[model samples]
Target: MRARKTTMLALTAGALTAGLAAGVAAPATATTSVLVKPGKARPGQNVTLQVPECETDGFATSDAFAGSAALDGAEEVEGRAGLATIGAHTPPGTYQILAHCGDVNAVGQIVVLPGTAPSPRPTPHGAADAGFGGGAGGVNVVLLGAGGVLLAGAAVARSRRRDDVTA
Candidate 1:
């Protein structure tokens, strides 16, 4: 009976070790996450989404988005990439963005800054007016003014000293 009990204990220990080994050898499950380009955006701006775990296609939806953005998994550059535009009148605040890719789902956040977006600047037609290229070298107006004031103070002190000596 004692021998039988010892054998049973040994067998249980061996089975546990084998199970652990198999678990360690098994392939790790894929981790899925949705990435939002320019995580923070202004209203009416477009944002890019990338979800590598999506096997075929995905869609990103958010209250801030103008509409649901379709994602294509076929693109090699950005996996399951898509573009979603922020609504023009979306209120300023943090909004949750959800991406659905087949059975997988991921979540991300986008912040809408308060105030309207500035209009896009028109492309320049020709060379910019560089003003003789002098503006490129930064000038400290405060430092220049301080130096002038110091020079004036020194001149006044020197004149006072000369007057004293003459007297």
Candidate 2:
């Protein structure tokens, strides 16, 4: 009986090892490819990343920007791809965009151009010539006062109607 028990244990161990080896020998089935459009953009521009060979149902992908910003989107279908918007304040430089599909990963680079300088705002017309107290808080105060008067008038009318009905 002791010998039989030992043999059974050894057979079980051997079977488990064989099963693990078979699993390891099998090739992985998850394959993917990634692509990016226009490869270069400026801050505030939209960048599209395509994963043509992703899973049919969907897969999660992420974009790593300048090694700091990380954006994630899903690949819903074969042709449909992920998208990430370059931040408006992203500095002008070369940045990387990474797309991950299961164990496969792809990377692309983007060059951001320095945006044009903002035009200086023209000085407003003379304060008296401008509307609403030179675009200050005067208009807001006047509107608030008018609203308060209308509310008070409504309350007075409602109270008078109630008093007449009661009488």
Q: Can you write out model 1's per-residue Cα lDDT over 67-119, one digit (the tens) per residue?
A: 99998865465568899988999999999888887767778888988766677
lDDT of 2 by residue, 1-167 (tens): 99999999999999999999998997555444456666776666666667665443233333324223222445454543755666667777776655555445555676766783244478876445445444533457678799899999999999999999999
Give the lDDT of residue 10 in candidate 2: 100
Question: Looking at model 2, how many pairs of residues clash?
Answer: 0
- Each model's Cα RMSD: 13.9, 13.3
Kindly report which residue stretches of model 1 are placed more than 4 angstroms away from their true locations once superposed. Answer: 1-31, 74-78, 123-167
lDDT of 1 at 60: 88
Best by TM-score: 1
Q: Please report, in order, the local distance difference test score of every candidate based on alpha carbons.
A: 0.83, 0.61
The list of candidate 2 runs beyond 4 A from truth reads 1-33, 56-80, 116-167
Global CA lDDT computed for model 1: 0.83
Error of 1 at 5 (Å): 27
Candidate 2: give the clashing pairs.
none
